[model samples]
Target: MTNDSPKPDDDAVRARVIEAADRLYYAYGVQAIGMDTLRTEAGVSLKRLYRLFPSKESILEQVLLHRHDMWNGLVERAIEGGEPRERLLAIYDMLARWFDEDDFRGCVFINCFGELGTTTPRVAEIVRTHKAGFQARLAELVAEAGGPQSLAPQLAILAEGAQTTAAIAGTNDAARQARQAAEVLIDAALGPATGTAQTRTSTTVTTARPAFRSRR
Candidate 1:
């Protein structure tokens, strides 16, 4: 006689593990969290967890992949239904909202890179791929906006720097500051012929720096 019982959904179990790992790894460095903690956090039996992911590294890899999908979706939603210029600026708008979140930590890729990139080749490669993907997306946006390809890297740098600065400074002001600088860069790239009079005027004014305070 064969006993029939419903088996757990592998996909759902895998997603739970990845989601739990993402949160745990983000809050605590990946190396600090062990498989036992992950299993508990995921609310999965150790046997099931091991069945889904043989090792912590495997779980981390899935988490990063999930994060990549999330990040891409976020950018797509932020830039949707906007003109090319608005789409470009919308990136900063998205950043501002993200930075204001109570649980806001730095970029997961950057954080993970700092933690594991040196010892783990795969983590480093995933980070590099994620960044390159963003830069490529920016290049497409710049091309659509009639800005030179060179402008995309500059904008990407500003966005990257803003993320680091916001994380370190513990303030969302970096987004506004980066957005101001981006406006200048965008106007210069598009030149006076294409730039709006308002943007042209704004570029001439000096932007005041925000005062720094230690979050610790």
Candidate 2:
């Protein structure tokens, strides 16, 4: 059992700042957004917002972390309820909706890195760490699907590429096409193991629920 007590007020304020930053960064490129604009957009006072994230780059780190966690949570839940092949396909299905947003810019991690280019060590670290986790989980799922070690890295590249194309092409259909291509790649790599994958698919008005959370 767990008690869901409210966080201390300051912590809650900081979380709100991070959420606002995430929304802004997702809709607009990080370089295009400034702290004053963020203060106005978040409706938090300059003094208070600074207390939460001392710098815009700091806010960038939080934004990336929050979105990466949310993405993992959604995918983990989808994978749990789906079969192996379905689980593999679920990754793209999760990305597809993001492309439909009016302000759809691109995959945040890749986008941020492209802009930063290792100039900010902390921000760079956040992207690398988040992506490493993605690779690790993807590898595990690939192995579970009875794929070779090579297949995990290969599938990860495809997934990342799919997200890139969706953002670049500015259409939902691009992602679908990429997913189909990835499925073919996975099939060729795994042989008979392909059919043994997914057991179910998601059909709903609701977003896939988060399957995991931190102890905090």
For all predicted structures, in order, the TM-scores are 0.85, 0.80
Q: In order, what lDDT does every prediction score?
A: 0.81, 0.71
On TM-score, the candidate that comes out on top is: 1
lDDT (Cα) of model 1: 0.81
Q: Which candidate is the best by lDDT?
A: 1
| RMSD in order of candidates | 10.1, 7.0
Question: Which portions of model 1 miss their true places by more than 4 Å?
Answer: 1-8, 192-216
lDDT by residue (tens digit), candidate 2, 37-118: 8888777789767665667776776677678778777767666655566677777777787678788787788888888957
Clashing pairs in 2: 83-198, 83-199, 84-197, 84-198, 85-197, 85-198, 86-198
Residue 158 miss distance in model 2 (angstroms): 1.1
Instruction: Kindly report the root-mean-square deviation of model 1 from the true structure over all alpha carbons.
Output: 10.1
